[model samples]
Target: MNCTSLQELGVDSNGIGGKIPPIIGNLSSTNLSKLYLNDNEITGTIPHAIGNLPSLTDLCLDNNMLEGPIPLEIFQPGWLTQLVLANNQINGEIPKSIGLAQHLSIMDISYNGLQGTIPETLSNLTKLGYLVLDHNQLSGTIPPGLSCSMILDLSYNKLTGQIPDGVAGLSSLQIYLNLSNNLLEGPIPLEFGNMDKIQALDLSANKLSAAIPAQIKGCAEVEYVNLSRNFLQGALPSSIGALPTSLHVLDVSFNRLTGMIPQSLQASPVLQFANFSYNNFTGEVSSEGAFANLTDDSFLGNPDLCGSILGLAPCSGKHGHFLYIAIIVVVAIAAGLLAMVCVVDHDLMKTRLRLTAPSIQLSHFPTVQGNATGKKESDEHPRISYRQLVDATDGFSEVNLIGKGGYGHVYRGVLHGGTVIAIKVLHQDHAGEVIAGSFERECRVLRSIRHRNLIRVITTCSTPDFKAVVLPFMPNGSLDSLIHGPPCGGKPEGPRQLDLDLLLGIASNVAEGMAYLHHHAPVKVVHCDLKPSNVLLDGDMTAIVSDFGISKLVITGARDPEVGEASTSVCNSITRLLQGSVGYIAPEYGLGGRPSTQGDVYSFGVMLLEMISGKRPTDVISEEGHGLHDWAKKRCLQHDVDAVAERWLPRDPPSVLPFGPPRCEMEVIVVMVMELLELGVACSQLVPSMRPTMDDMAHEIACLRDGTWRKYRATGLKAIDQTKSKKY
Candidate 1:
């Protein structure tokens, strides 16, 4: 190839793997303007010879596996316009000469192991607009003369000292300014109030102290603020409560703030997530506006704060104290009178008590059954009547049905109040007693458990002939639809519409939900019916675990008394007399081992594998025999991800071209796929004891979601080094 004539070499976003050949640098094309070999699995040190391309204007070797210090020689190109080497393992300090590239406008070297103080010469890049140095080991105080036209992120670093006052003059700063998770201490710079257009500001997890300046309200466009986990003292400025209407999140927990929470904050309509926990605030906790929907979890650790919120004491007044004393006197007087009357007419009183006791005892049965239904209802989730639900679902029309399960049909409903909801109606049958019992059990479990990844039970309706569970409407439908692309009915076609990050995110969410059920919730729940269809997706594509129809409550050292006779019937119904749904049941569960957390883990593993490989477990038509786990285990042994990747990736040459959407490194994808398959194999072990806990599975999936699997692998490699270096 005549290399001198080449102006560009684009091999980005393909399934290319392995190290970038050093010989490519031999091109030395004087006319080369762009080197687009990014988003591939190319490893090893970037060839220093590529610096010889004097005309190269853009270098895009990002999101790859290349390591080692960036070649200082690359900075020789004065005409370089953009340099994106982010999300790689490249170490060593950024070259001081980087500022020599006068035309450079973007430099992102984030999420790497780069160390040493950020070079002060960076301030010379007048045209630099985006400078990201987050999630690295960089130390030293933040540089002072950074260009105003940049989105500066020095978060998750060891930077110390106060923020530079010069930063306040940067009128061009508009996007984000994050200096969180650092060792920085001192008062927040008053100049920060000058960034009128800044959208997000996160200065949390620092040693910074002093009251938040009232001047910060000047940031008119700021939408998110997180100043939590600091030593900041004094009451939160009242102005903070009145921040611009654009603000959505304000978290200032773990501080030394005192006094009543600003009532203005309670009135803020746009604020969604606010935390004031672990503060010295005292006063009546208002249940108006934002506080109306907030639970006690948001205001815990403040003993002096009383309110109408559940789990909090109601405010008491002088008159209330007098009323309590008067009630006590009246009760004492009535008891004495009753005792004298009983003594005078013992036989007559005994006969009257016998008649009344039976009626009272009969009423206690319904009270016990109601208690079995779950915690008391709150205004946030008021009990909806069967009639209201019927009207909301248009008299249970089939056209409104969104899904179906053994419990009943899930129909999309719009109430008279204009609230969209998902109403899950239960089937009334000869097993009326069993259905009612299951409904109570479901209510018990759902009411007691609350997490971001767990489905929220809005309200429930029960009648002699019908029962239903109401939940918030999930617009994105189910993870099953997003994973398998749905079965006809005018759903969008082609790819499953899930990218690598999104798929891992979904898996992580499901794992998180399972982990919470297994270990963190008020009661240990085993989601006996865990499958793709049971996982719903919200508008933000977040996966929430749903359908706890057959979930079992596990109590340590004893069986749950609440789960009594009803659970036995539920277990039979859910396990399909023994085994769960084909392709998703644990091996031991089929042998009458009973529902446990390990069973849920095994089901998650199978669903995870099925998601990666487009084959259903029931369709076990592979040469490996058994099901998806067996086939994936065979593929894992062969160390070939392509066997399963073929089911998801486009095979046509045109579709695989460089200009296509960015893809995760096929090599990284293979590693992730292999690890996931190994997870399946581990969870599906014949002996239940050999399987990993749902907690472990959840952690692993979280690691994969955040791109930390490689770091953990690197740490494991170091452990090997430590073992080998030890004396024999």
Candidate 2:
């Protein structure tokens, strides 16, 4: 019989359902270069002989029920470049023969039962760019020679040893380099500073030691660098000041460093997130430049270090009164000159400007209402008066206060027409000359946005000294209050116990609100701060996202500046100046200060995780070890997630249990909780790109809810059918 060519077969989403054909290996003479068998219910083991096709360059067997180890014969040729065998029940070690395929660039073996050491030979592929070996039992040292330039994730494994020195030579590395939650040891290689284009570097929760190498200052393009929970020692490098303005995140907590912080390091405007806590550093902490904004928490647990940060003891010793005197003398001299100039030149300046200026017609302020001709008479736009807002907010009384946040306080008020509203008043400190422009930008953006999930910007008031926004009131309060506050008091049971269904419902709504802001709104708005507190719920429990004070409107068609190449350090500095609260801010924002859609996704992911875990993102448990994400992931892999969920949400059956079986209700709750936990795990993935988009997350939650409801309904129908058959 003539052997059929594999090319003769076309299996691209043809709805072909069933197991892999036993005779698949017979097509040995096929000239096929691509084989896609995704989106099918194909089952059983992959045939060993199936790898005989020498011309195969792209093989996608994902979204299938395929099982067994990757065929060793598949790695024989150098033609293969893309191998996606993910989302399968595949097991066994990756064959070392994979290294022979020198052209392979993208290999994903995630979400499998794979085990054993990573094949060192696989590192020889210099062209490799994306290598994912996550969520496996892979063990042993990472190959030193593997130098993929893009992303190299070896998380959620039993991998050990120091990061190989060859990794430092991946000069094309841009997005991230994560080797967290591993058994890596020894000092971080000084050679890593040579990766000039590295964007984010995470070596947290490892056993690495020694002072952070001064050589790191040479990584001019690096934005985020985390050395947390290491045994590092010695004072920070003064040369850290030489870092390019792109640097944003610098964490060296849980170390043994000492001595005064380098003043130069503190002066860099690009440094937004810095945590030198739990160290042995000594001497008076300086607050000259960017450091002036940092509080004791940034440098906490270092008893010997003193500063002016609130809650910390003030610095003692010498008081410099002469410097204060000199500043007063200079100000007095300038004031005297200003008074003389005002008296002598006031009339001269006005007459000179009128003579030199062009004559123009003046327009009066426009009326608030339109005329019969459908044209406004004045040029001014409608502006809410400050007094009107004050009256609406009951003279800014404390009783009206609903919530307080980093930017300002939110108040619940009722207008004269009985329209309930939320009023936000700027904090006194941030209400300065420098913030006036930002206030205007926010007003302009909020007024233009009119989405259901987004908090409606009814009106705003802006004066030289005061700025505030009026919004529709949310009577049910914020999600934060419900999750973290004391139980509601009116009912016999103190606070209404939060069931899994209710929690998932609220999470779905929050995701929907975030999705609208990220993709559906007229302008792409990044709600820079996305946490429980920012999500408000109305009487019907519909979630509405609030707080746009620091939100950014991403202009369509505008290209983000190249990561490593920008005109001025000022741009990077300006970006870093806007980093929001600690727990919710994306890591990238604290690294290079570059903002992207991924940043908002990361924040959303954190919130999703928080909702499921019923724990604050910054809660002490999270800070002690891996975050809630890591905790949930570990439990999920072990199939013990139900026990973990029960810790946060009790499963006590209702006393007046309905007519339905109690066991059935318990099972429904268990399944719902598990689904929510899985969603949380996906959202808080260590890799920002791996996290689901808000739109996808919302859809997934909706499916979970709908799926559960359908199952419940079907069970009821089945019971009725069984009773009818019994009667017959």
Candidate 3:
């Protein structure tokens, strides 16, 4: 307590435990200008007495286990400039007296348990530049007068009411202003267009309504704008598509926005990614500039949209022209009848003018309902009737049947309107309630979770006697048929050889999809029946995971029966045996272990190993006594990417990957495959607890992808992206 002359102290990341000592308060060290105690395990409430230090300025206690409300006395010191207390257990409302430290340039208290409305006094700090209060339990509207000059983030909170005009109209935000994942309502402010210097703007996952303002094009430097998962309506502004040349990413998925996608987006020289999924967008998708290599992932859930893009039906000009002509002819005939009636009733109307009035109707006009939640499914999806399915599938004839499973049959169908879909029809002869229950569960999972590498639902039909799920027809088909060939006694689709690069890409996509199911989705999920068949390839050979038949939601797992004799036999014989994916089932399940995300990882690992080796896990299981896990562990020779490259190809390559140095490229491919095999072995270890989570698996796959993509560039090999379109 007598250390009055201490000028500086730093104890960051030292595994320090226990409480913030109470003695720290009595240190009236007037000379102490810097104090750092962040990245510790210290617990207990912050001591109010510490504020007695008259000259104490920099204090950092973030990334600790500190609890209770922020002490009111800490703001008494006018010399304090930076305060960091993020990633802690701190609670209670931010004290209104925070404004007392007017000299504070940075204040971060994010990722805490803090609650209550943000104090309006924040605006008083004219010098404040960066303010972060994200990942908290804060509620109430954002303070009307925030003064952060560079960055202001209040995302992932319970904020309510409309965003203040002053906040949106601020032109000084140079970095970004993120108010995403909140309850902000009303139209996006037109004043937001005035922030010409801001680089990024994110307002996704909110309840904001009304049309996007055309004025947003004024943001001359903005590169990213995310307005997805809102209630915005009307066509996208052409000006947004025509944003400044710096704009790269624009997301407007999961809204009610309608009409044609602006052609200006396709012409953007810098735009790399644009998401328009799950909206009411119509007309043809452009195939130029940024849209040149786009996949079906960008346009899912918009059935009316025709395009040259993969997975979308090609627009038929002859049929469309005749249809338009027919509609115009019908309207003309209706107008003629109405005119004749008006002329005949002119005299009658004058005689009865005092008693009644004539009402004109535009009865020939076509109208469609908006695709918002809570509306009938027919309104959002194309209205496909029961007879329509039968007609499309020709009464579920053998010629239309694409595949069959224990629980259902899959039929390839094309609707009269020229949309191709795969229909999974549940067997009516199966256990009635059990079949219905599984169908409902699959539908629930499909409808709630969405990702770029996950199969998207078209629409589902349910009836007392018949239940079916409709999904987009994957052009390249399932990974099982691609690598291992289709099941026995079926028409051979011919040999399909996947290169190491393509296989790695498919593995990465599957991992990403599993990560979404396990951790990132609105509700955590476990794809209990993950296997090669469940992983399908889209038109670009991009992987799309499908079939959530035996998936489990972690929150609702307790309600389901545990894996045992009662359900184990049924599960193995049905979803597993029917698909010959018993080799993909985690060994823990055989011992009655419950379904888990780790189990999904194990299955994915088995699939990954299979992709690299081009052999099934069950090929010689009985004779060999071990599956691909042991095989990979023994065959894979772990070595550094650079070391392997040097040993196999000593000559420096003139060019990088996807280009010259053919022998070096092949040898480098072998090294990457070995690395992936190592990952597979780790994931498929016998102990379920030893398996890496899907999140970790996804990250590792991405790292491997990037590492392989750039490794060749290190050996004096010039790397040039042929997709020369500039991107940030």
Candidate 4:
């Protein structure tokens, strides 16, 4: 093993389930350039003899059961380019000697038990691209020397003091800078604006004070910024709207910011997510362009901010000029008429005039246009009418009926302009108030939620007698139609079977959409009813989450036992009445638990299992007397991937000549199916805490379509077995 001829060695994810052998460092092969031992079950402290490999350029031993402090001697390699020991129990401070590796470019030691402050010596590694030290117990002020990295993530640490001024001068920082959830205090430095190349910056959950420096507009390339949960005060710089067009997310909530929200934010085309809640902002909230989609939740806790957002009062000065004239005319005419009536017949004429005046006043009410009450061109939506919807849907004809649900029936329609749409008309037979409430709820939810994988609401028509929401028609139809439609439905826009590619793609898209709803949206939304039929597919086979009629907004820190509990009891009752589909509901919900984001995760898990096993949750209960998770877990526990695939696909694995070249594609299929089934089983775990988050699910499913998993499959089932017991 000490031979100098060795150049590279890899034994990754090979089911090596014992302590790492001391002899691993016996490979004194001076010519070795790369050493990969990741994703295995190797344990014990790293041997110091690894420093003998003078020519090593990459050293990866991550995602294992390794414990104890990393050996300091490993940094002796002058040519090392990558060093990853993340997700281990390694303790002790990162050695200052790490700076000696002139070629080091990527270093990830996150998710560890490491302690102590980051070494200032790291600044000597000029080529570093990624520096991740999150989820550690390290404390102390960040060293000013480490300012040139591209991706700097020091979140979830106990670091205090102001951010080092040198960080602002990092011209090479093009990825992200995250220092959130720390005890750092003092004003944000104006120097941050000089980091023009950075994309994302997060300084939330800190003790930082003072106004956000107006110079932040100079961070021209930033797309996302989160300074929430801080002590920031004063008006937001109006120049905020002058930020780069790439700006997508800006959250300054939970602060003491006063005065008006910057108008520039309303005009930003790419600014999709903005949370100004829990602030002291005053004056009218803008409702144009990006603001048109925002709901009252975005401005909650700001009592002084008035706007057209639901629940907020309209500003006194809004339409003041027009209303003033109208009021004066009505008052003068009424006074003159009353005097004449009093003179003509006294009490008799007065009683008769009162009855007629009420009717006349109602007939003179003005028609208000636009989604929001504002004088901005960008707030305009196609002014749709109830009569137009009736005409387009052919008088609600049964022939055009596309689908029906608990709240409404959907009909296919073609408008006068030759645009095709799906009209969701509420069931009028239900109590008019209930129907109206559902419509308003949908409007509020849809207004604030925006994601490519979520359905887009085109326009809405509302009148006393009728109400309907128009959406773009999805020609590819719902996932339910693709999976369980009539046999003669013909080929779909994409694949028919839930193949590895299509299954992973659809699963990834759904996870992304759910993640956005649960975390990234302007306001958190929990889609209480997530199921196959609710997931529609466009022509490109992209999955989009539809039907927010029963969604609930999650108010941060609010003590509500049920969805919408912060609101009236009627709202909570409505949520309970529509608590998701039968088989897809989480176990807790059956026991009177509240509908929550976790419940949605459980439902997605069931849907994932259904996609893989082709068995509904109800079918499992009726036939096997348990949920789908039990059946899948039973097969998984028996190490019977073949049985699960056979029951679902029911086809033999592709056969090739004996001792011939291994079929790489076939390997990927088998490995992916087994892994996916395992993931489904994990997600549908009886304990909600045991279930993986939507973000985690998305990452793992995405791995199935990525090259790393493909290569892992080529290595055989030993690799998949090694990862099964690992954390989600």
TM-score of 3: 0.46
State the lDDT of candidate 3 residue by residue for 526-623, as single tens digits. Answer: 77878887788777889999887766655544433222322443353333222223368775453334667778888889988887777777543322
lDDT comparing candidate 3 with the true structure: 0.73
- Candidate 2, residues 332-398, lDDT tens digits: the string is 9999999999877877877877897622111222223332123453544334577877887778898
Root mean square deviation (Cα) for candidate 4: 23.3
Alpha-carbon deviation at 213 in model 2, angstroms: 16
Model 1 C-alpha lDDT per residue in residues 1-728, reported as the tens digit of each score = 46668887776644356887766667746788878776555789888877777887778787677899988888888788767787679999888988788777666677789889888888888776556677789888878887735356777878888778776556667556778898888888888778886766888899999988888887876777889899998888888777747676788889888988888888887676688889888888877787777787888778778877765556887675466557758979999999898688877867777786521111121121121134453334565677888888899898998776545678999887787889988777554665666777677778678888998877677666778888888888787777766653357423337765567788889988898999999778888878887888887888899988777886677654356654686676554422113357765453335878888888888888877775666444212224565567655447666666544443434322321222443555566777777887777654455578888988888777566544634544555455557833
- Looking at model 4, which ten-residue stretch has the lowest summed lDDT? 359-368
The ten-residue window of minimal lDDT in model 1 covers 359-368
Better of 2 and 4 by TM-score: 4
Q: Return the top candidate by TM-score.
A: 4
Model 2 C-alpha lDDT versus the unseen true structure: 0.65
- Which whole-number lDDT from 0 to 100 does residue 399 have in model 1? 91
Which parts of model 2 are misplaced by more than 4 Å?
1-383, 428-431, 486-497, 558-580, 620-624, 636-639, 647-660, 713-728
The 10-residue segment with the lowest total lDDT in model 2: 358-367
